[model samples]
Target: MGRLRRKLKKTLIETSETGLSLELRLIGQFIIFLVTIMLCISLILVATGVFKAGMKQNIALFEKELSHLSQDIYDDFGNLSLSSVSLA
Candidate 1:
């Protein structure tokens, strides 16, 4: 009877230990998953910010070129008008 009780006790301890280990493993996996999601979100935000900044810079450059082009067109028109009046 004593031997039987000892065996039962050992079995119960092993079962509890196994359950505890499994629970710990699941918790670790959950934490890792959460960290990965956070990292992905942070990276996406950083990339989007960089892209927005680059787009703004490109837009500014394009606007500057357009302004220069319009100025050149106006100057040419003025010169043409003067030459035509002088010829007439």
Candidate 2:
């Protein structure tokens, strides 16, 4: 009867240890998953920032070109008006 009790105690201990080990493994995996997700978020933020900067630069360039074109149009209109007055 004593040997049987000892055997039962050993089995219970082993079962509890197994349960603890499984829980720890699950926790570790969860931590790793969270870290991976954070890294992905950081990467996406960096990429978006770079994209926004590029878009701003492009918009500035476009505005500059539009201003130059508008200036040319205004000058042409002025010349046309002057020529018409001279003719009149």
Count of steric clashes across candidates, in order? 0, 0
lDDT of each: 0.92, 0.92
lDDT of 2: 0.92
Per-residue alpha-carbon lDDT of model 2 for 20-71, expressed as tens digits?
A: 6777889999999999999999899888886476887799999999999999
Q: Could you tell me which residue pairs clash in candidate 2? A: none
C-alpha displacement of 64 in model 2, angstroms?
A: 0.6
For every candidate in turn, the CA RMSD to the true structure comes to 15.1, 14.5
List the lowest-lDDT window of 10 residues for candidate 2. Answer: 48-57
Candidate 1 ranges beyond 4 A from true positions? 1-47
